[model samples]
Each structure stands twice: as structure tokens, then as C-alpha cells.
Target: MQDCRILITRPEPENTLTCERLNTHGWSAVPLPMMEIFPLKDTNKKAVIRAQIFDIDTFDYVIFVSKNAARLACDWLDECWPMLPANVHWIGIGQGTTQTLLNEGVPALSNPGHTTETLLDWLKPARMRDQKILIIRGEGGRPELGNKLEERGAKVSYLSLYERKKPQYSAQTFFMLPDINLIWITSGESLLNLSEYVSLHKPEWKVLPVLTPSIRVAQQAKKMGWINASCANGADDNSMIKATEFHIGKQND
Candidate 1:
């Protein structure tokens, strides 16, 4: 793994950190953000988001679906609330998301992938029949969380703070990709964007090793015709690094 060159496809800020982490762990990391995040700008969507923020106290729990959502939730709370509601719980599905909340001085119960099952297991003993939940996320996120909450009878609502768009990489940029040994993808959308690039250009790269943050996302990559996609235990830094190491070892073997 000493010569491992990994292609990081996460969005900015996070991708910068990921590159640093990978380098620290002895991997050569290349950052080429496949997707970019942008806040909702349509007046009608903005109004809907504002209305949700205004009614924040009404929900029993507010769950952030990503690091982007958590940060935006902080911003929205700042716009209207003098103080955070005392009774409402905050949830973030991954370590990155949870850490984002912590950075904002919000103690989230759980939402990072490794911790998500713990949150659901914790709910098993509670009465969700009458609970109210608000899931804050970017556009086109998976609906499984809300669907599961509803299955338990919790009234579920969603607030989308941003949209994830494929970045416009120049044709030259695609041609200049490193001799990457591994590709790291944390989200389905990231995988989708990368697949689009591979589909249009280096079709042979489909067989290159891919490391995904979760089994669900790995499955998605496979369904999309990725020839070799590996699953990490979770999206937390340790899990990703460990999975990357596994891919490295397996390749070297």
C-alpha cells in the first residue's frame, strides 16, 4: 500500500481533510471533487425551509442527514432562535455529520453510520407512535430513514437545505487523472458522478478498486455496473482508512 494513489471524490472542505488524512496514513491522495453542494435558492423552497426552521420546537427530534445539512441547520437556527430548544433532540447519521453538530456546539444523539444503528436500537424501547421527527438533508437523499420512522408511527418531515450537483470537470481534467490505485466514495451521489465520468471516458477504469462507506452504497455501485467495489464498516474516518488498507492488502496479495 505504500504506493497507493487514491482518488477522493467527496465534495470540498471534506475532500481536503480526506486527502490530509490519507496522506498521513501513507496513501497518496488525489482530490477531484465529483459533486458540489449549494444552498437552496428558489424562493419557494427557501420559504419552505424557513418555515421548517421556525417550527423547529414542534419536532421531537431534528435529524441532519449529512455534514452539509448539520452546518446548514446551525445557520438556520441562528437566524431565528435566541436559544436552542431545550427538549428537542438532534441527530446526525455519520461521524462527520455528528462532528459538524459538535463543532456548532450542538450535542447530537447519533447519525454517523456506525452510530446510526445504535440510534435505531435505542428507539426500540421508546414509544415512537406519537413522536415527531424532522430530517434535514440535501436534495435527492435517500428516504429510508423517514420511511422507517414512519413505520414506527413517528410523524416524519423533511427539510432540504442544499442540492448536490455534479461538478463540471473539464475534459482535460478527466484525462489528467492520476494513476490511481483506489477510488474512495462516501455517498451514492458521489459514486453516480464518478460513474458518469468513467462511462464517458475511461470505461476501462470500471474495474479499478473502489472503496465505499457503507454496504448500501457498495451495493449501489455494483448495481451501476462498477466491477470492483468494496464496502467499509462505516463512514467514520477509522472505518474508511481501515477499509482502504484492506483494499491495499488485498491488491498487494
Candidate 2:
């Protein structure tokens, strides 16, 4: 027993899922969601719909950055182009997104690791050149992936599927201690959102040792004055659990 009770700062329902997993490991999970996600009001919804009706042969590849993006793209594609062309190359950022594509009966190649750099590294000089790639993602995501692909001479278009917003405060968050042992921040936005919340409300949960999934997010946490932050190698559930274990163990020692 590590006596490592963790607090997850992912927004809402996701915190419940993380808490459930921590419970299985006999650790307490404290939820203090840092942000909220809402659907972006697409001004070009009709255009998106119209484009979806086009032949799949028009595009060489479809890139999905997150499971949410994959699900939304798959749903939209299914509505317009009921039968997906077998020739289209589908790229998933990680196993979760890959699984989402697989469930939708789409053949997709997943990046070995769940980061923008990892995904670009996997494509490299061989696969990305001259490809017409459609990237389905959330609004305000890092443009590094698209910019890198463009640098390699690949034609890339971004399709914004959703928007992320700040979640309202819960009284539970007001009661949390300022220095929780570990703060689970799954996204850069969440880290920034938490900082914003602190700046506004001066909540009890202040600076914390953050557990993040990527180096960029860790950097963001540090920039926000979170002194201790550890980046998981990947975004998988096991990776988060193991990263948490290591940080908590280090603290105990």
C-alpha cells in the first residue's frame, strides 16, 4: 500500500473514471476538474457536411489526434459517405484513438507514443511526403503536427470538431488542500485552466506536483508555477498509473 491518494484535475466525468481506476489500486482519488469541454458551434457545418459527401479517393490520409476527434469524424463520415474507401490511409495519434477507429470499422495505424512529436517521428520522411492529409482535432490544439507535415511538403487541412471551455467550480474543489501530493493534469489546457482558476478564486488546491502525459504539458505546468511535474511516457491508463506510482514512491522515500 503506497498511501498515495491522488487528485485528478481532468474535467468532470473523466475524473470519475480515473477515480474508479485508483480505487481498484486501493488509493483515494480526489477530483478537482480544471476545465470543461463543449461542442464548437461550427459556422461551416454545411460545408463540412457537403465535403463529407465527396468520394474518399479525394484524400490520401485522415489523421485523428484524439478519441473525441476520431469519434466525431467517424460519425460525420458515416452519415455522408456510408461506405469508406479501403484505399484511404487512417492515422491515429495513439492506441485509444486507434481503438476508436477500429471500433468504427476503420483501418488505422496508431503512433507508438501519444504525443505530437512521437506521431511525427513515426511518419518521418517516408510516409508524410506528398500526402493529402485531413486532420480532425479540437480547436486551439498545437499546430506543430500540421506545421511539421507541411514542412515535409504534405498537404494538411485541419477540421475543428470541438471546443474546450473552463468548467464551473465545485464546492469540493474549494475544500481541497492547497498542496495535494499529486495533481493529475491530462492536458495542457487543463493545466492552464487550473492556473486560471487559482488566479481567480485562490482555491485551497494551489501549487502541486503535476502528473502529465506529455513534455509540453509538463512545461506548461512549470510555466504556471507548478514546481513539480512528471510527464508520463504515454497517455495510456497503465502509463498514468505507473507514473503516479513512481512520483508517489519518490515522495515517500
Candidate 3:
């Protein structure tokens, strides 16, 4: 392996662990986070908390979009209500979020695909109709999941747990280095941020294959005229490694 370098564009814990996993699998992995998440200001989030305080038991299900959402929402839950309602079902978007719930001594419903569209697909036809669902998420996440829930006759309420913003451009991200073998994008927003950050630096380069988990991210990159972008079918560490191996082989030709 002639240093098949890959860059991971996910944030914080996800990026760090993803890089470690790639290294374990015999790839030179570099973490280049394009977005940073910060807990929402307490004062700003209090209103949303207050609104949901009374109707907490009215919700049939509580959904978590990310681990951060699950952690933050549970923290507040511990403070407001001594114990969770015994009958309320908990749903998580993926393995990561589901694990968070599991750690809290609950086995939550895990959606097959991590994306909102797939999550909605998994919830529809049977579970969503007449369900009172409360979505625990960050400020300004994709509205598709909530909108789909509403359209499917679910009474959906969103509980904002935190916020995320574009990370400041890292000077290290621009320094001339060997062309990357594969660039991994874990989030659609991070992919967009990576493009904007690269555009600001205006790195002189030809074309490099970019791998992302979502079609939406690939489309965004395509709009920027980045032709060598593709979506990975399986959204996991194994799938990312497989995609990287495939692209590296193509690049060698």
C-alpha cells in the first residue's frame, strides 16, 4: 500500500473514531472536520424546553437524529423528569444514535438507513399514522423527516437539543500535500462546507474522487462541477473502506 491517503470530513468523535478505524483497516486516514457542533446556548433553548414540558407524556414516541441529540435531550430529561415515561417508545436514526439510547438502558428502534428519507420510509404506513412523535435534534437540521412525519398523519414536535455551524477554515487543510486517494464525507452539510472551504482557498487541482454516504451530497458536489463524486451504497465504516478501495484501484488506472 503506497500510502493510500483518505480524508474524513465528519466532526469530532465521529471523525476521530472513523480515522482510527481506517488506520486499523490499513489505510492512511486523516481527519479534516468541515463542521463543528456546539451545544445551543441555554437561554436560547429554554423556550423550546418550556413549550414541551407539559405535553411530554402526550408523545407516543421520541426520536433522536444524532448521538448529540440523544445525549443532550437525555441530560435535560434527567433534570426535568426524574424518570422517562414507561410506555414511550424511543427511536434513533442509526447505529450511533441507537447506541446512545442503549447506553441509557433502553433498546431503541434503529432506522436501517441513517438519512432522514430512509428513516421516514421505515416509519411510514403503520407506525407513523396517528403517532405523537417528538423529534430530538440540533437546530436547523433537514426538515424532510419532520415534514414526512407530518404528511403521514403523525403529530410531530421538534425538541432542539443543540446547534452546529460551519467550522472555521483550517490553515492545515490547504497546505499542499499529495493528492488524496479518496475523500470521505459523512454528512451532506460537511460536504458542502468542504467545497466552500476549498473554493475559498482555491487549491490548484484537477480532479479527485469524493465518496459520500448520501446521494444528496453527491448532487451538491456535482452542482459545484466536481465530476468525480459518488454516493456509497452502504452507510458504514465497512462500506467507506470498500468504496475507498474501489476508487483507489480506479485512480491507479
lDDT of 2 by residue, 1-253 (tens): 3656677876545567778988889877777777676655666864774474364457788888887777777877887777888788888987767887999988898878888899888888466678888888888888998999999999988777777788778556565644356677777777887788767656444555677889988887777777777798766567788888887677668
Best by lDDT: 1
Best by TM-score: 1
Q: Select the stronger candidate by TM-score from 1 and 3.
A: 1
Residue pairs clashing in model 3 are: none
Clash pairs for candidate 2: none
Q: Which stretches of candidate 3 lie over 4 Å from their true place?
A: 50-55, 78-83, 170-173, 176-178, 202-206, 249-253
TM-score for all predictions? 0.91, 0.86, 0.86
For every candidate structure, what is the RMSD over all alpha carbons to the true structure, in angstroms?
A: 2.1, 2.7, 2.7
Model 3 agreement with the true structure over 90-200: per-residue lDDT tens digits: 888877678878897655888788677787778665667888988888889888888888888899888886778888866665776456766887777887788887776
lDDT of 1 by residue, 1-253 (tens): 6978988888987899989988988889999998899999999998998898999999998988788889888998989887888899887887778888999888787732453454676677778897999989898887777887899999999899999899997678878877878888888788888888889887887888888877778889999888798788666667788887777777679
Misplaced by over 4 Å in model 1 are 111-122
